[model samples]
Target: MFYGKYYLLFFISCSPFCLLGQKAVGIGTSNPRVTLEVAGDAITRDGIEIGVIDDMVDADTSTFLVQEDASNKLKTLDVSNPTGTALGYIQEYIIENPNEDWVLNLDTNISATEFVVNTISAYYNRELDIDGYATVPNFSAYIQDGTWRLTADFPSANNLYDNEIGTWTITTLIYSRDLSKQLGTITIPMNNGSEGSHANPIID
Candidate 1:
């Protein structure tokens, strides 16, 4: 009868590919394996699938940038020590460092939990169109029984067209952390290369 209906149409077209046999190809595949690892050699067995490590969210803690003391007049000192303990002074430190605007006379506002800072002392007057010079000084302090004795002297480049002045005195030895309440500021950096208006001095 037509060779048993051609063997029942080749067993119903192979019975849906033998009922989907021998699967497991790759990543939930239907014979989809572009390379799930299958080297050579007959007897080989290897399986290592490690991928799913997602759990990290913690990073936010970095903020401490202080530098904004452009002078607002808060230099006070009224004295009182030897247990009667007292602190408050800045009398004056006005050179806002505007490239060394020159003019600072702070003789006393003493405060030292410890002391020793004097490396700034200057005097200038030699002109010839100014050629080379530099200066940078900043300091402000106040705390539990304040204390400081710093020094510095710098500023000199007189030659090349007159008006070359200098004066730098930076000394430090400030201390006061017993009761905790510290406040200090200092930053000096001056590089001169003649061009007009180069005067620095007066930090008594």
Candidate 2:
């Protein structure tokens, strides 16, 4: 009867685990429809990593993580207009006179409705010369005709005979209105040189 008693003790010890295996486990709810369910927020110390662990080592700022509606699985959602938002730089934009405006044709496929543009960086500086300096130029960007356009305005200056040279570079960022997605970036570089009759001429 000693052997029989030991076997009964063993069965009693294993009974709870066997029942747990077949039933759903609920942390904050009495009734759980899934294998594991939490009624409230759950926190993980190590962080939740989706997709293949090895493949997820690298992180992309342009992509976001979202749960798929059909599969109910987490996946990486890439920016929709990767190629459509690409912008080419202008090799040479000339500004022959002061207070003159130049239109820079941006080579891009960004749509007005899908994304908005903002100037993240705008910088202009005239060449270091004695008694010859130019004020900071104005800049504006917009999307039109299935592309982008940049307008540069050089304020009027009395020093027309002053020989000044420098460069202006503007970096623009394109993203969704909600700011959830980053479409792309554009950098425009303008080389300026003005001497004699020309007010503020851009060579390159």
Candidate 3:
């Protein structure tokens, strides 16, 4: 009775997804639990693979590049890292620094913008605060084909003082198409001029 039951148990174990008692195909592994058990270093010529493989590190251009360093250390340049794709960078900014100011780099190859993001056909420039209000310096820039410009309206309504000779430490954050970086602070000396408008951003 014990021998009979042992054979029955073996038959039942291979009942589902097993083929005619054939040997299973194990990819990158010696012991395969399933019909196609791939333990490591798996690759599909056409299907979508998430990560890169070291086996093809020398000649694989279809996936993220993997190469050896000067110290003979292998390095993998993660494709997921910022290659400066418009939507990729935009999404990263939204996730990492949601409240941070977003700027565009107008000096880069605008062709990418024209191809992916919305087109800036004409001379275009904009500046706004998180509250949707113009900043104290009214931070702004303009870049068209053959021109580059930046302007700010210092001593804005949000920043008005009563001193005859005052200073404004403007913290300027930049987020542009080709660049997203902190440009540090700018010291703008101000003076409530002897007349009307304040000499806020003294361009001298």
Q: Give Cα-based local distance difference scores for all models.
A: 0.39, 0.56, 0.39
Q: Comparing 1 and 2 by TM-score, which wins?
A: 2
Give the runs in model 3 whose Cα sits over 4 Å from its true position. 1-26, 29-135, 141-143, 146-150, 153-204
Tens digit of per-residue lDDT, candidate 2, span 102-165: 3345444656666666655555454322235555556767777856565654554323335544
Q: What TM-score does prediction 3 earn?
A: 0.23
List RMSD in Å for every model shown.
Answer: 24.2, 15.5, 19.2
Off by over 4 Å in 1: 1-88, 93-111, 114-130, 133-147, 155-175, 181-204
lDDT of 3: 0.39
Candidate 2, after superposition: displacement of residue 110 in Å? Answer: 2.8
The model with the greater TM-score, 1 or 3, is 3
- lDDT digits (tens) for residues 125-150 of candidate 3: 22323344454433443565644433
Best by lDDT: 2
Winning candidate number (TM-score): 2
- Model 2, C-alpha of 150: deviation from truth (Å): 1.7
Please write out the lDDT profile of model 1 over residues 50-90, one tens digit for every residue: 68756545543222223225843233222333333223212
